[model samples]
Target: MRFLSKKDVPFKEVVPDGYIDIHSHLLPGIDDGVKTIYQSGYILEQFENFGFKKVITTPHIMQDIWPNSSQTITSNLKKLKDVLVPLGITKIELRASAEYMMDDLFYERIKNNDILPLHQNYILVEMSTFAPPINLNEILFEIKLAGYIPILAHPERYSFYHDDLKKYDELKASGFLFQVNLLSISGYYGEQIKSFAKKMIDQGYIDFTGTDVHNYHQLEVLEKGFEFKIAKKITSLMKNNIEFS
Candidate 1:
């Protein structure tokens, strides 16, 4: 019997039409994502081709590094939109939000009600891959108190939790929604992350999925990932993103 290769599978087969993309870093120049308006347009055009109906492009809001505010994200989003119209890349609807790093700054933002929500008061959040914040529970409590649903970005990538799988269950019990990265299932981050992603899916912990695309290289990798055997499991979660639409 001839086994099919990953190249034989296409990304469109996994993601359906009118699918809503809940995470990405397509905003140009504000973070580590696409560097210019042109690059942003290129990624969006690819998103359009991949059957994404809308993309909620999230830029990093790490206080020490990116420090992007609602004003900054909104401004760059407008700049990207203006360029996209000229590039004829208007098929996919675009919106802006922040992948907030859970730090002191984020706590303050929660207190001040200064936040850019993804949709319907849901906010995408991330913690250090090295270690979660010492005051994580407090931050999560504040997030809920502020009326924002906290969706943890790429839960499988957190190395600290890899050893203690029950931490995932604790997080779920705490009302944290998990967004697994599409690339992780493709083994783009590494075998460890890839395995964890699969495990998360098996446990039914993944609430949503995202490309988390930062550059052209990653985007290409994302396309190739569709060919992986695990892509079938990831496809099931892809439909969940439309809730944000």
Candidate 2:
């Protein structure tokens, strides 16, 4: 018997039944995400093209630059959604959350209950690559005590932990989710980062994968993830609310 052709199958049939993109930057002009509502709409179009079901755009809430609040993110998301409404691009759903920076500002936000957590009470946190925070554990503990699942974003890109991966081990044991950057798997950050990413994957410590799309170049790099083995694994494993679902 002749083999069936891949072209005969519908695109939707091939895609995972449901896609929950946990990390993205679709909010307009908040931190390093999309610059305008037009760009945000563009990203929505891409999500539709990619067969994504639920798109959660995460904006950075950092101290030095993106000192944004939930109100600002909400307003921006509305503008972006309105732009998409005219196109009637209702095939994909959109949500907004913050990629929190682990700094004094994080503590302040937690104390004030000014956080925009992702689904399952998960909060995204990013640390500096060059230096470890003086109060890393304390900050994570505060976030947990505040009732949010802390996720360390792009842990492999942080060089400070090169000598000892134990930092990640400790954080994991302490109950922190780890999100790896897809671009890093493609060596977008560097060879060292790529190595770290591979190590993390091998150890089965990575829980989520994110595009962390800031602009076009990053997206271009991420597009190449389909050819990489680890990337393929991540793409297959990403599911809705897997951490607590």
Instruction: Return the TM-score for each candidate structure.
Output: 0.96, 0.87
Q: Relative to the true structure, how large is the alpha-carbon lDDT of every model?
A: 0.89, 0.75
Query: What lDDT is obtained when candidate 2 is compared to the true structure?
Result: 0.75
What are the per-residue Cα lDDT tens digits for candidate 1 across 1-245? Answer: 99887555677778866889888999988889989888888889998998899999999999889999999999888888888878998789999999999999999999999999999989999999889999999999999999889999999999998889889889989989999998888779988898788888988999999999999998998777555566577677898888998
Worst 10 residues of 1 by lDDT: 225-234
Could you tell me the lDDT of residue 130 within candidate 1?
89
Output candidate 1 Cα RMSD. Answer: 1.3
Off by over 4 Å in 1: 6-8
Q: Number of clashes in every candidate structure?
A: 0, 0
lDDT per residue for candidate 2 within 56-143, as digits (tens), equals 7789888988888899989988877777879768888888888888889888999788888887688888887778689987887788
